[model samples]
Target chain A: MARKIVLIGPQRLQPTLAATVESLGVAGRIAAVTAGWEEREGEDRELHEHLGGRTTNLEAWTRVEDVMSADGELTGMIRQRADRLRAAHELYRLRLAHALDAARELLKREPQAGFEDLLEAEREAALRAVRVVDASHLERVSAIHAEFGAEAQPARRTSIRKHRAELEAQLKPCELLCIAGGHVVVLLHRLALLDVLGLWGERRPIVAWSAGAMALAERVVLFHDDPPQGAGNAEVYEPGLAAYSGLVPLPHARRRLRLHDGVRVGLMARRFAPDRCVALDALTRVEWDGSAWRGEAGTQQLDRQGHLTEVRS
Target chain B: MSGFVAELEQEARRGHHALEAFLRGRRFPVVDGRSVTFVWRGEADEVLLRHWIHGLPGGLPFHRVPGAGLWFLAIDVPEGSRVEYKIEVARWGERRLMADPLNEHHAADPYGANSVVHAQGYAPPEWIAHDAEARAGELREHAVRSQAYGGERRVQVYLPARFRTTRRYPLLVVHDGEDYLRFAALKTVLDNLIHRLELPSMVVALTQSPNRLEEYADDPRQARFLVDELVPELERAYPLVQKPAARGMMGASFGAVASLSAAWRHQGVFGNLLLQSGSFVFTDIGQHDRGPLFDPVVRFVNAFRRNPGRPAEHIYLSCGVYESLIYYNRSLMPLLSKSGMTVRFSESHDGHNWENWRDRLREGLSWLFPGPLWMVYE
Candidate 1:
C-alpha cells in the first residue's frame, strides 16, 4: 500500500540510490533497512554517506538477533519455522528440478516431419507442468508463513514488541524507506518479524534495489543458469511481501542467467507469464506510481520469444 | 598414421623437403578426434614417451621412421583429456628426458616443465587467465616464527581488491602456496572468481614448506606449525571472521595431506577444506609400496580412514582420473560422506599436475566459500 515504490538495480558496481532519490525529488531523513546484509547489517556508513548522511538504519537484523538471544521461546519458534521452510523448499526444489528438466528435454527435441504442431502442444504442456510446480511451491510457502504468524503472534511477544515500538518511533519522522540488497530470504524474514511493511503501510514512498526489489514482488523466484553445484534450475523461493505486483524482478540476470539461450529465456518468461520477468541490471530504475509501472531507458524484460525487450511502460 | 603425419613421412622420404622445414610451420601432437599423434624430430639412438597417465604404459617407444630422423607415436587419447609428458632421448647409452621442443604448450611443476597436450575438447578454463576488468588482489609477504619447524617460515597473504579494514573476511590457509601461484595461477583465479562474484573476497595465507616431502607427509610438527602458530599470527594481524565456519584450508598432493591432517588434528578450527589430488597412500593389510617417504603418510591415512571424526563441516575434494592416487581419493569420499561432512568430489580426465589442480579451483573454492552471487544480485 506504499505511495510509490522505486526499484533500482544492484548498488555494488553502480550505485543509483542517490541519483534515483534526487530524480524523484525526495529529500530529508530516509529510513533504511539492511537486514539482508545479515552479520554485516551494522555496516551502513557507505550508504549513509551516499544519502548525504540523512539516513537512519532501522537495525531490523540486529533487533531480531538481540530479541532471539533474549527470548528463548521466540527463538525456538523461529527455528521451527526455519526448519519447516527449509524442508518445504527442498521438496519443492526436487519437483522443480524434474519438471524443468522434462520441459527442457521437450523443448530440445526435434519435431517429426509434419508433426510440429503436435510437438508444440507437448512443449506447452511441459511448460504448464513447470508453472504448476512453481505455483504449488508458492502456495506451500504462504501456508507456512500464515501458520507461523498465527502461532507466534509476534506483535504480542514481549521482546519483539519492545523492538517493534522502537522501530515505529524511528520510522515516524522518516520521509522515505531505502532497502539495500543482500540475502533475499534473510531480508524477507527480518521484515516479516518486525512487521516493517505493516508499520510503513501507505505512509511514505520507498526505494529498493537488488534483493530488496525482489522481496517486494508477489512471488520470489531464485534463478541461476550455472552454479558450482547442482543442475542450476530456477525455483520458486517463496511468496513476497506483495508491495507491488505483476512483475518478477530478476536482478543480475545478465550474469546469473543464460540470457542468450532463447529456450531458457522463453521458458522462464512463459512460466512466469502475466507477471513480466524484468531483468534489473546495473543502473536500471523502475517505478510503480500506485497504478502503472514506468521504467527508465535500458530497462528490459523477457518476452515470449526468449528475447530481451525494452520495458515500455 | 594420420594424414598429416603420413604426408610428413612422405615428404621426408622424398628427401626434397627438410624435416625441420616441414615441422617448422606445423604444430606437434596433432589431435584428430580421440587419436593424438605426437611427432618428434631429433637425432637419438632410442626415444620414448614418458607420461604419467594411469592405466597406460609409463614409457611408450616412439617408432623411428626409416630413412628419416623423424619419430612418431600415436595414441588414442580421450576427448577433453589433458596429458603432460616428456620425450626421453637416449644418446651414447645415456638417456635424458626433455620437454617437446615442437610443442609450445607446457605445464611447469616443482621439478621442471613437461609438454602438455589438450585433446579435442580440452581448453584451459577462462577463469584461470588474468582478466583486465577484474581488479587484482594484493599479495604481501610475511615471515612467521615457527617453533615446530625451529625457523622462520615465509607466508604470502592475498588481500582481495577493494579490501577494507572495516570489513571482516574469511580465511583460507593454502599449503605449497608459491607453487600454486606460479604453476596453478591461484592469484589470477582468485582475482577473477572474486570479481565475478563466484567467490567472496577472502584473506588467503599461502604457506610453503622448505622440506615438503617430509613435512607435508602428515608430520605432527607441520600440523602444529599451521594451526598453532600460523593461524594465530594471521588472525591477530588481519580483520578475519573469527568463526570456524568462515575458516578454510587448501592444498594439492602431499600438500593436501598437510591440509587434511591440520584440520583433523585441530578439529573445529577450520570448517572447510579444498583438497586436490591428495597423496593419501594407505595399506589395509600390508605395507605400502610407495617407499620410506610414505611411511608416516600411510600411518596417518590408515588411522584417519578408521576414524575421520568430523574434522570439518564442508570438504571439497578433486582428483584426476589419470592419477595413480585417484583410487585412494575415491576411497576416502565414502568415509568423509559417512562422517557427516558435506563432501563434493570432482574427477577430471587429467594427470597429477598443476594445471589439473588449477582447473578444479573454481569448483572447489566456490563450493567452500560461495560468493554473494546468490545473495547479492549486483
Candidate 2:
C-alpha cells in the first residue's frame, strides 16, 4: 500500500507539529491520537491550536476500556495476555542482556589471530541468539492474537467492531491524522485497538512525532542508553502497524542514545541490518512519499559502519 | 520610624556602610534597603550601567560618591532576577565597555564580555567561595597524550584531604576541567562538602579539552581518548573503583556531552554522569544553537537514543531555569528516565555558567556518590 507519512523526532518546547501538518498542504479537518499522553488524554488544547483549531482527539483509550467493560471474557483474555507478555518480556530482556553483554565484551577484546573473521562470526552468533529471543516473543504475541480471533465470540467481535465503526465515522471527515508523542506502549495499544492504520486510507497524509512516529515502523524498538537508574537496552518490543516499514525512528536520540561509539553504533546498525536506523531529533522531519522517503536538512541515518550520515533530499 | 529608614540610619553610622551593604568584598548588587546597589571602583568622568528591563534597554548613570573612587547606582530589582550588564566608562573622550571585574559570575558569549548580577535569591551558594575554615583538597596536574586525538591534554586531579593510597575511591572525570575548577570553584565546593561530610571523599579528574566543540560533540576520537586513554591512565596512577558505577563523568555544556559520550562508548566504564547545563542540541531542536557546530552533536544525540544499549548506573542532570538550553535539558530528563536510568534532576535559579553548575554540585554529586550516607553530624 502506498504510504504518505511524515515522522518527526521529539517536539519538546520547540513544537514543529502544527507547522509540519500545515506544510503537508492537506489543510482540512485533522484526527489525532493522543493516547500516549496517558492520564492527560484530554490535554489537546495546545495541539488543537497548532493544528489551526480544526482537530478531533479520538479518545481511543476510553474505547478500549469500554470494550473491556462490556465483555468480561475478552477482558480476562487481555489481562492474561498482558501478564504473560510482561513475564515473557522479563525473561526475554534478561536473555538479550546476557547475550548482548557477551557480544560487546567479545567486541571489546583486542584483536588476535584471525580475530576479524572470528569476531565477525561471534557477532553473528550473538545477534542470532538475540534475534531468536525476539522471534519467540513475537510468535507468542501472534499466538495470543490468533486465539483471540479464532475464539469467534460474537460479543468480543461486536465490541471491537462497534468501536472500529465509531472510529471510522470520526475519521471519515478528517483529511489528516496527527499523532502526538507520549507513552509509546499506551499509544501503540490504543492505535492497534482502534485499527487506526487499517482505517487510515493510503492517500491521506499522516503526521506523527516521537512515540507516534515509532508506532508506524515495521517493528517498534525501545531504547535509552544513559537512563537515570538502569542500563537501557535497545529491544524489539512488538510489531508496529507496518503501514510504513523499513526505517526505525529514534525520537529524542540526542538525549537517549550513545552515538559516539563506533562499535555500539555499528552493532546497532548491524543488529537492525538492512533497515536504516533513523535519528529523529526535534525539528527533524522525514516524509515517505509511497515509493521513496525524503528527509529535511539535519536528518541523519546510521551507516552500516556506525557513522551518522546525513539524510540527503 | 520604618524598617527601611532605620536600616538606612544604622548603615550610615557603620562608616563603610555603602561598601558593606552593597559590595560583598568585591562583588556588587548586594541588597541594603529595598534596593540592590551596583558598585564600580574606577577613575572616570562618568560610569553608566546598561541593562534591559521589561524587554526595553535602559541606561542609568552611576553616582560618584564624594571624594571616593567608587561609582555606584542602586536599582530596585525584584528578587531572583538574573541580569547582565556592562560598565561604560566615559573617559579620555571615548566610552569604554568593561565587564565587572569584581563579579566572577558571567554568561558564556563569544560576542563580548558582560558581568551577570545574581540578585537576591538567585546568587550561587555561599559554600563555593574559598573558606579557610573548610579543609581543602589537593589538585595535582598531569599531561597525558592521546593517540586517538593525536594531542596532549592537561588534566587536574583532585585528591580529598583524607585520601589514602590504600583506599580506593570513585573516579569522577570532569570535562572542561579547568573552567569548572576556575569558574565553578569546584575545588572549594568539594572541600566544603567533604569537610562537612556531605559528600564522600572521592577522586576527581578535570581534563581540559583541546577543542571543546570538535572533541566533545559526538566525537568518537574524544570518546576514545576519554574511555580508552584518559580513564586507563587515571586507573594506573590512582586507586580507583574499577566498576563503571563507581566511576563518574561530569561537565557543563559541551563538556557534559563529552562525559556522556565517554560513558556511552564504554558502558560499564562510567556508571555516574553529572551533566550541568548540557548543550544537548538535537537537529530539529535547539533553534538557537551554533549552526555547523551542532550538526555532529545533533547526529550523535539522535543515534544514542535510537540504539540505547545499556544505561549508566546513576545519571544526574542539573540545568539553570533561565538558560536557553533549559527546554532541551528538561525534555531530556523524562526520555533519559524512561530509558530505565535512576535519574536525579535538579534546576538552579541561574543560567548556563560555571557558577550555576557549581551550585548544584552538592545536590547532584551527593546523590550520585551518596558517600556521606552514613556520616553523622556532631
Candidate 3:
C-alpha cells in the first residue's frame, strides 16, 4: 500500500500544521507525539487548539519516565545503551571534525587553471572521508541497537508491552499522526521504545516538522554551521525511524547553516549524495505520495553546484 | 595623520572661511574606518580626550589646528567598540571636563551622562528596541515588608503578556531594576525576546536599593532580604515555579556581587545567575587598590575564592574587555566551573556600563532559560 507523508517547517513561531493538514484535506482525530517536549510533554493545549481541539497528546515522554521508574532492570540496560551511544557519537564527532576541516580547506583554495580537476578530486575524497565516518557511526549505533534488542527483548517486557498496548489503543481511533519538533534524540527514543510507527500502521498519513521531520527520515544528520560553542561540524546522529527515505531534512537551515557559502553547501550536498539535502525554513511544505515528492512554493533543495534550487518531483 | 584631519588642517591654514563652513556642515568625532577623530571648535589653553576605556591613556591630548581654534585628536578604536568620553578643556589655570558640544549621542548613568562614540560596526542590538509586533509585558509595583532591612521595599514585578494564573513560570530577580529599565531598556528587550521565541515568557522581579554602594557590596542583610523576604513574597503573590532550578538572579557591577553573595549564602535558592561586569575585586597577596568603596567586595570575593561552594547550577558571567573588572571576572570563571557549576562566560569590546550589560541580556537570558526556538530547532 502507498504511504502518505507531509513535511513542514518548524511550527513554534508560525504554526502551519493545521493549515497544512487542511490543505491536504485531512480531517478527523490527530494522534500527536510531543515526546520531544520532554518535561512539558502533555502541555499541548496550543497544539490542540490549533488543530481544532481534536488532538490527543500521546504523552510518550511521561510514559517512558514512568516505565523507567517502575522497571529498574530495563532502566539500567537503557542507561548502558545510552553510554555506548555517547561513546560512539564522541568517536564519530572526532573523525567528522577532521574530515570536515580537510573538506573546508580544500574548498577554500581558489580554482586554478590546471588544479581544478585535482582540487575537485581532492574535495571529493575529503567528502568521501566524511561519509565514511558517518556510515561507520551509523553502523555502530545500529549494531548497538540490534544487540540491545536481542538481549532486552522489549516485546517480551511486561512494562513496555503495557504502555505499547495503551498507545496502540489510543492511536486506533486517530486518523492522522502529527509529530511536533523538539530534541530529536529524545523524541526518537520515546517513539522507538513504544514502537508508535508499528502501532499506527504504515498506510496512515503522517505529518511532522523540524526535528520531528528529521526523526521521520532514514538517517538523521545534525548540522549547524555556527553554534554558541564548539567547532560547528555537522555529524550523523543516528538512524531515524525510516518513516520516509532518500532525504536529509535540515530544519531551521537559514538560521543554523550558512546556505550562502557555496563551499559548505556543496560539501554537504555531495557528502549526502543520492539523498537530497532539503532546506526546510519557515513556511516550507513538501509532500510525499508513495513514489515521488511534491513541494509548495519557496521549497528549496541543495544542488551539486551548492546553489539552492526548487524542489522537483 | 588621517586624510580627514589633514584636509581640515589644510583648510585651517588656507583661511578661516572654509574651515568655519566645514565645521558647521560636518559632525564632530568623524569615524573613518577604525580611526575616530574628536573635533573641538573652541579656544582653550589645551584640549584632551577623557575616556573610560582601560589600557588606553586616561586622557589623550588634542593638537591645535595651528592657526584656528579647532583642536583635533585621532585615535584608532577597534571595530564594534562603543566609547564614552568627555572633552577636558584647560584655560586660565583651571581645567574642567565637559561633554562634546558637537556630539549629540550620550549615555546616562547614576553619576551623570557621557558623550557616546560608536566606532565602525557598533550599533545597538535590534532586539533592544521597542517592537510594535511584540506584545508588551505588564510591570506592576509592589511594596514588600523587609525584616532584614527593617522597612518597606518597593519592587516592580514584570508579568509576561498573556500571563495565566493557572500556568506557573520561572522567576528572574533583577538587581538595579529601575536603572535597567531606564538605561538598558529591559522591558522592551524582554518583550521582544519573548515575542521572538528566543526567550521564554517568564516572570521578572525588579529590585532596587536605598543605598546600593553599601547594600550591594555583598551585605548579608541584602542577601537575607532577597532570598528570604523577597522570594517568599513573590512566590506567594505570583504563580512562580517552586523549584530552585526555575529561579534565577541577575545584576550588574555591585549588584552582581549581591546576587552571587545571596546565592552563595542561601546555597541553592537561585539555580541560574547572570552577572555582568561584576566589581569582583580580590587580593591575592596584600590589600587591594580599589579604595574603601570596594572593601566589602574584596573581602567577599576573597572568601568566595577560598572556599567556592556550588551556589547555582548555571552561571552566565559577562564582562567588557575594556573594563578593569575583566580580570576579576575572568578569575572567577574557573572557580565557578571548578565548583561543579555550569558556567558560560562572555566578553565584549565595550565597558562596564548599562548598555554593555543590556547587550549581554539576550545571550544570558536565552542560555539560562531557553525558549521554544532552541527547543524546537535543536
Candidate 4:
C-alpha cells in the first residue's frame, strides 16, 4: 500500500500535522528540544500543573525532546524489519534454485539440447509441489504504524530553537519536517530548531498549510482580526506568521493561503513583487524532489487575490 | 452499475475527500474525519425549518434511516407560512416536485414553490399533492390589519385566479392570509368549497401580522399600517370592494383579535367578521385602552343596538377550550348577539395552534355563505 497524507478541515488539521512531527522522534539533529502546548487554566488547578508531567503526560508542551529519545528505537525497528523481509525473500529464492537444479539434472537429455521441452516438463511439475511462506510472515514485515488518534487540548504556545552548528557536529543521518497553520506563526523559532539539526545534511521534506502554508513563500500576510462587536459579544483574533522563502522542490502550499484573502491583498502583492502572485483561496500546494521544486496554486494569473484554493482538481 | 451508492460509505470513511478537502492549517487524524457537517451552526431561534440539501448546488439528501418512517428529518416550524423548499436525493438529483411527508401544513406554490417542514416531528399533511407541479408564483405583500386598536399592522389580500379586468366579485376576508392562502392552500379550499356549493364564489383576503406580537397586542399603529398599506396594496393587485360591508375580516390568536379590531375600528370599510380564538379583553394587552381603542369595541356594540350596522350583517366567532383568551370570546359573543349582530359562534376542543385555527377557518367559510364546493371567485 502507498503512504498517504490525511487532512482534516483547515482549523483542526493544524494539530494533526504537529502530531506527525512528534512521532518522527527527531526535530532535525538538535540535541535538545522543547515545544509549547496551547492550554487553558481550568477550574481544577492540579490538572493544570500536571499538563506536561514529563513521564506521565508529555502533552503539556511539544514533545520534541521526548520524541528524539524514541528515534533510535524506531530507526532500529525499521532496519530490522527491512532486513527480515529481505532474508525471507532470499531463503525462498534459494529453495527455488535448489529445485531447479534437481529438475535440470533429472530431465536434461543431451546437456540442454532442447530448452522448451525440458522446462515445460520440469517446471510445471515443480510449481505444483511448491508451498512456501505463511501469511503471518508477510504481515509482520509489512506493518506500517497503522493507527493514530489525536486529541485537542486548549491552545497554549511556547517556542523552541536549536543551534545548527552544534547539531551538525553530532548528527550522522537525515530527517524530514512538515508544518501547517500554527507552525507558520513561529517560523523564526522553527529555523532555530532546524539550524541546530543541520548536521544531518540529509534530504528534508517540508509541507506547510494556511499560515504555515503561506510562510514558506517569499512573504506572509495577516488576514483575520476581530470586528467591532456588541457588549458581551467578542471577536476571535488570529495573528499572522513570520515569512521564509528558501525550501526544497515540491508542490507546497505556497499560493493556497491567498485564495481567501480577497481583493485588498491583490493590491498589496502588486506593490511587493508585481511579478509574484498568490492564489485567491489559500489552497496553493508545492512539491519538491531533492533538486528542484514544482508547484501549482493561486486563482488568477492577472490579479493578486491572496485567497486559498482547493487542493484537488 | 455506477456503484455510486457503494462508494458513499467509503467516501464518508475517507472524510468526503471525494467531495472536498479539510480546512488548510489543520492536521486531521483519520479518527477526526468522522462527524463533519457542512451547515453553519448558530442563528436566531424564531422559526424552525427542516430542509433537504443533498441536491447539487448544495442539498440535504432525502434519505430514509433504517426502520424509521419517511419523516426521520423534521424541524419545528412556526405558525406563519411563507416557506420554500426543494426535494434533494443523493443520486437522482434535486427534484422540484417534491412532497413533504411530515408537514400537515400545506401552502400554495404560486411560483412553482416547494413544500417543507421542521426537521423534527415532521408529520405530512393529510391532503398534500403527490403529483403537483413545483413551479408556483412567489408570495409577497400579504399582511392583514387589526381593527379594534388603531396602531396595529398586518399583510393580507384576496386574488380571483381567473378574474376579468372589467368585472367585480363579492369579497371574502379570511383570517391568517399566510395560513389560509399559503399553508392551508385556500385557493384549493375555495376550489372545492365553491364547486360543491358549500361556500359562495367570493374574493378571499387572507390576513397577516406586522410583528405578530404587535398585531396581537392590538396596537393601533399596526392597525393603521394594515389599512393604509396592506389593504390598498392588495386592492391594487386584486379586485376588491372599497366599501365596508363589501369587505370581510378574519383571523385566529392575535389574528382573531386583529380581525375584530379591524372591523371594530373600520366597520365602514370591513363589514364581515371571522374570529378564531379572538382576544377581546384588550385590557390585559398594552395595546388596548391606549387612547380610544376601548371605545371602538363598546361603541360598536352599542351602535349595533340602534342600526345593527350595515357592515356587520355577517359575523363568525369560534374558540377552543384550551386557548387562553377563549372566555373573552365567549363573553363578547353574547353582547354582539344582543346588539342584533348576525353572529355565528362555534366551540371546539383544541389549542391555540395552527391545526385548531386552520380547522376553524374551514368551518367559518361554510357558515358565512353556503354553496357548492367548487365555485371559485375567478
Clashes per model (N, Cα, C within 3 A)? 0, 19, 0, 146
| Model 3 lDDT per residue over B224-333, tens place | 99988999999999999999999999999999999999999999899999999999999999999888999999999999999989889999999999999999999999
TM-score of each: 0.86, 0.47, 0.83, 0.31
Error of 4 at B345 (Å): 1.1
Q: Pick the candidate with the highest DockQ.
A: 1
Q: Which structure among the candidates has the greatest lDDT? A: 1
RMSD after CA superposition, every candidate: 3.9, 24.5, 4.3, 32.5
**Native-contact fraction for each model?**
0.56, 0.00, 0.39, 0.00
lDDT of each: 0.89, 0.76, 0.89, 0.40
Best-first order by lDDT: 1, 3, 2, 4
Q: What would the per-residue lDDT of candidate 2 be over residues B1-378, giving only the tens digit for each residue? A: 334334434554555756366345444555554467777777899998876342334678987764556677777765675677788899989998888776776764435557888777665566677777566789998878889977787789999985778668888888887887766778888898776555777899988776788888878998888888988999999999888878888888998888787778778778889999888866554443568888888787777766665558789898877677877788888888888888888876566655567668888887887643221111
Residue B7 in model 3: lDDT: 86
TM-score (chain B only), all candidates: 0.95, 0.76, 0.96, 0.51
TM-score for the B chain of model 3: 0.96
Considering only N, C-alpha and C atoms within 3 Å, which residue pairs clash in candidate 3?
none
Residue B221 accuracy (lDDT) in model 2: 90
Q: Individual DockQ of the candidates?
A: 0.40, 0.01, 0.26, 0.00
Displacement of residue A220 (Cα, Å) in model 1 is 1.4
